[model samples]
Target: VDVMHAAFPNKVPYEIVYDRVVPSMPEKYKPLSRREFLARVMTTLLVPEEKWCLGETKLFLKAGSSLELEDLIALPDEEYGEALFKHLDLAEKKMAAAKSIILAMQAFVYRARFLRVRRGARTIQRIWKAIKLRRVWRAAAERLLEERRGRLAPKRE
Candidate 1:
């Protein structure tokens, strides 16, 4: 194991030669043969597809680095928690941005609606004033026609 560690600082051999890296746990209590120990480590601790790859004669870590079994067992819990915190921080930033966008959209909609209503009101006022002016002009024209007709009529017989 030490030789492999020295030779390939970032890789581990999957062969029985490097099997001593597996530490005995409480359940086993008994000493494990090199093959058994390696099998246990591969099955129970490392996910073959994610953490490491099965090369022809070696296991290549996906992380591009390898550590002793002790380090592997100790680091993950803390690291996973830290990763979650970082993700949460990113999620919060995304949510805040989304909220800001929503608020801006709402403000834009409100302003558009307000301007439309104001325009409608002004249009209504203009139409109403035009109608009143038309009525007044029609009345004046009727009066002028009546005066002209009366003046042109012959005196009563």
Candidate 2:
């Protein structure tokens, strides 16, 4: 309502006799009527025609149109700047939190993968060591058996 009043600085109170009779008198002609003023304001604001209706006594707006109009009214420049800065700050904080969470998850996955690979490598090393030890032991046992057999047959010589 304050916005509407501000749009029409020279608006006059509607009077039936003055409105009907004064227009016919050339000297009393008003260039813009209330309805015409409202139309011009709505057009300038780019408000959709369907969103508003001009009634005899009052202007009617569709649901949510008034809120849209209110939003169209500019805030103080300082307040607007402050609001924008606050919103940006909040968004930055949220992004930072999300980044931290993602990094932690990545670290956990990397550590788990490293441990799994290390365990597999250690198992392979243990198996290889056991195989080498068994081969060496078997070779030593065979050499000892050959020696014993030779000694047992030496008496014939």
Candidate 3:
């Protein structure tokens, strides 16, 4: 695990990512081995709203604590689909916040783009500020969800 961590620094999990994702493989998806690599990618891409400082990609490494998403992840199969849908709704709400921020910044930029040069400059500055904020918030949340999704995934790889 340390070897893999040394190689993949910011992307490696708590040395147990392989352990957890491995045992959860449902019978149908038991053919995966090295496929655990995908889990790391998913963690980087999917988790959002986790604990992160601005521009931080590796929350665990930065926090100096082992982060476990499996503890917070719950998979509601067909029998629990209702709860799953509710969780999806919650996710939508979170996305809406980010979307609105981006949209508002776009509007400001668009309106100023062809006006006065000073206005355009200010707009561009604001746009950059908004983008930085978005990156921080979005990446943090994405990291959270992706890290947590290990067990909630299809279980069969």
Candidate 4:
């Protein structure tokens, strides 16, 4: 445990000593002192109070208790590395899925816009053709009416 503490200071649960704060207890229970708080933490970890001792600035534990604490704190490197890599792989897969969804939405919007523009162009072309046909029909009708009236009128000197 001392070696682990020396090697990996950050990994050890030393915050309790520095912070001097305990986990929340029952509302009826009074606030606990630092030593009592450390004892409570050890009890929760299945280490009896007899197995550990608290001094002015350090805590001492039996060999078995120290081993238990180390086991709880340190995971095998292989397991830790594998879990981290798996999490990253899963995140990357999710990102790819999200990107594909975004692209599909963009394609859908572009297609809808193109269809709207095409429909408007077709409507304009239809209107133009109708206007041209109406002019030609009107001119033809006027010429026919003039010829019929001339034949029906009386002869002039």
Best by TM-score: 2
Write candidate 4's Cα lDDT for 16-133 as tens digits.
Answer: 3324222323332236565665555555455776666665545667555665556533555554334333443465577799999999999999999999999999999999999999
Better of 1 and 3 by TM-score: 1
Collision pairs in model 1: none
Per-residue lDDT tens digits for candidate 2, residues 1-157, read: 6535434222223342123333333332256675764555455455688767665655666656655334433445444334433443465577799999999999999999999999999999999999999999999999999899988877663
lDDT, residue 155, model 4:
64
Report how far off residue 101 is in candidate 2 (Å). 1.4
lDDT of 1 by residue, 17-129 (tens): 23232332223423665444444455444345345444456555544434444355344554533442344346557779999999999999999999999999999999999
Q: Which residues of candidate 4, in runs, are more than 4 Å off?
A: 1-75, 154-157
- Evaluation by TM-score, superior candidate among 1 and 2: 2
In every candidate, how many clashes are there?
0, 0, 15, 0
Ranking by lDDT: 4, 2, 1, 3
Residue 70 lDDT (model 3): 39
Query: Candidate 3's C-alpha lDDT?
Result: 0.48
Question: How far is 54's C-alpha from truth in model 4 (Å)?
Answer: 39
Error of 4 at 122 (Å): 0.8
